[model samples]
Target: MRGTLVLISLALVVAGVVLLRSKRPAWYWMTFGALVALVRIAFTYNSVMEACGLTVPPSRLRLMLARMARREVPPDRPPRLLRTRVTRTGLVLRLGLRPGQDAFDVAASTDRLRHSFRAYGVTSRELRAGVVELRMTGYDVLKRVQMPAKTERDVMRVPVALRDDGSIQYRDYRQIPHALNLGATQSGKSVYQRNLVKELAPQRVALVGIDCKQAVELAPLARRFSALADNPDDAVLLLEALVGRMVSTFHVIRREQRISADIPDAEITADIWGLPDKLRPVPVVVVIDEVAELALWANTMEKKRRDRIITALVRLAQLGRAAGIYLEVCGQRFGSELGDGITMLRAQLTGRTSHRVNDEASAKMAFGDISPDAVLSVQAISAERPGTAIVGDYSGGWYRTRTPHTTLRQAVTTCNDTAYLTPDLPELAAFRPVLPPLTPAGPPSLIKPRPRPVTE
Candidate 1:
């Protein structure tokens, strides 16, 4: 009877764990997963390192000393575990490298360690000269997106998504002035853009949109846009107006550039951010919903229009950073097949994000030159997971990221609430969209009044 009772208790515990792991992953990690991972790491650390060939042979001095004392040969030395920290998601291990071992050696063996430790994932980075930090996750962060409580937000930086390793992924316009976002149809690209817009709505910045698809994607949030263009002709006009504004901003910066021997070289400012608050113009973010729409041209007149549009885009990508203008170019595919300047425009976009692309080539367009591994990672994104994306930049570092499911209604409400924060740019006044007044909701009248008959 006692043995039967023990078996039943063990089965019940196992069932509870399985249920918690599938349903409440965070709770599982806190109550059971973290403890198991810690115990595994402690027990399997040495053997896992040896099995993965991460153990370095002991120094000649130590071996010789052991032999001189008529003792057994010294075993290979694995990295010393300097510290271990348990986080909400997983464990952080700080390791002190052996003399012959480097961070790469440890990084290469992370897969083995992860499997041995039974972790969901593992990533390693050099913390300093002789130390490496390994971040292991106990659960798949992208499976259910719950953003961390603390995120780094700044003047032009917004946390747009949660990274696979339980860190926030920020969209920093200052660091990367231009970015390319690529995703196929039904890939949740629009949802990502909505999240971006909602985050930017409350900031004191000007938003200009070029949605050549009849503004269907951007029109819902038109209240927050300083300038909007829906067609090729109107888009050209808006681009010209933006160029004019950029030129004016440059002139302002030139005037304010007080270059004197008394002033330090660092103090001589060139960008708008360095100017006095009163003299500084508001920053502008230009979002292109479909870059392909602007690049594709059929006839002679259309070719000229396309050339003009591409030229303006190239100029903005090349010089707009210094004038407080940034670009967020989104499309299904932006390749050489699009046009002549398509590759050039792409080269200038340092930040790249690829959603579930239709083909390997589409993924390559975003991450080919930066990270070949990232291309493979992008291709691995399943169509079933729409918002999951591989995000990378010029630094060649990439991460799996997923934006939480944000409804269009929520984005529109956020924009409407923060509409007053939109900056007024005089140059874009002519292109501003005029939206109809909203009707107020009210209770239905119980007694219907007699309608006016034959009034006309």
Candidate 2:
């Protein structure tokens, strides 16, 4: 209505200038439009707050507090809003907890708050000693792509996707060396991988891939990979080779360490990061697609091979960080039931992202122990919302997030463009697979032309 009034007012002004030759009525209409907009906001503000249960009438608060202080049975005193910080995305409400209220109470009421306000989503966090922060997302943040702003290059930080708050979420592989990205088939899991791979392609890093599924997902991006393994046998070999590299890297670190007069003994280094740039080993990012296929066993022989693979990966997870090796483990579902060492592997993966899943169990497998609330958030993601996910870290920081749509062709093109930039890793040269080019579609030529050429 306000927009319509504004348009009508503009039309009236144009008519007065062109036809009537009188500006008086045009000014009146413009004033009316402005008033309508202000009045609409004023009228809806109170009702919107009331509907969201955000407004606390002073009389009701006093009565409720009095009853609670008098030892009422329920003791249902509502939390008082202390203040709010408005931002472009939404407002952050800071609430003062009542006698028996806590941060969890506000967090538990997020569903109700979301429904009442008709908001896209709501999240809560604890602030200052006793305050609870309720961050309400006012709009559908995941409806479009939220690209990251360009900043100075930081090799350790790779911008992955956008959080609901419009801030870029980075995968700090240097700090969190390993990550577990979980989502069902076509749940935008591959898109996340594409973002990571494309971002890392030009960096001074070695890319290695283990795709046990159809091999179509990572195979196309092989131009950027230092080594590519399509089956379990090759995966085992590649993993073992990585383990050798890790041991050798540690050996170099030990040899390079020296007790300097100015440097403290505690600051002595044992990682490739401590070495000079020219002398530092090229960092390796190991991508494992469908880790479950590598873990699942079919026969005695397969079980042994799986055990070796798991042990190698466990060692990599435990000690690979200092050696400048990182893992990006992608799978549909990850759980303790997968195998013996699966739980150990998961514990090392501090960063987790769970996209749309077929069941709550899969979501829990990714974040249950880390944060139960994150599991609920992941459960709320419908099948229609493929890219929507819950991302969290070991510090209990979790939020709803989504990656932008990146086609397979784009990802492949990115890899191809940066293929010439792939760093040489002497340790992985033997394991690198040289894939054969696609054969032509036509039949082979006959050998009947040899006699005619000789006669000529």
TM-score of each: 0.93, 0.74
lDDT of each: 0.89, 0.78
Pairing residues by index, what is the TM-score of model 2?
0.74
**lDDT, model 2:** 0.78
For each of the candidates, the C-alpha root-mean-square deviation to the true structure, in angstroms, is 6.8, 12.1
lDDT of 1 by residue, 1-456 (tens): 999999999999999999999999999999998998888878888888888888889899998899899999988888899999988888889999988788888888888888888888999989899999999999998898988787767788988998877878999999999999999998979889989998888787889999999999999999989999999998988898888989999999999898988887776798998988899899999999988999888899999999999999999999999999999999999999998998999999999998999999999999999999999998898888889999999999899999988898998887776676777789999878798865546876688655222100
RMSD of 1: 6.8
Q: Which ranges in model 1 have alpha carbons more than 4 Å from their true place?
A: 1-10, 438-456
Output the lDDT of residue 138, model 1: 92
Q: Model 1, residue 48: what's the lDDT?
A: 86
Q: Clash number for model 2?
A: 0
Candidate 2 per-residue lDDT over residues 63-175, each given as its tens digit: 77768799544423356657766544455667786554557766767887767655557788898667888776655557665564563347767777878865667888888
Candidate 1: lDDT of 178? Answer: 96
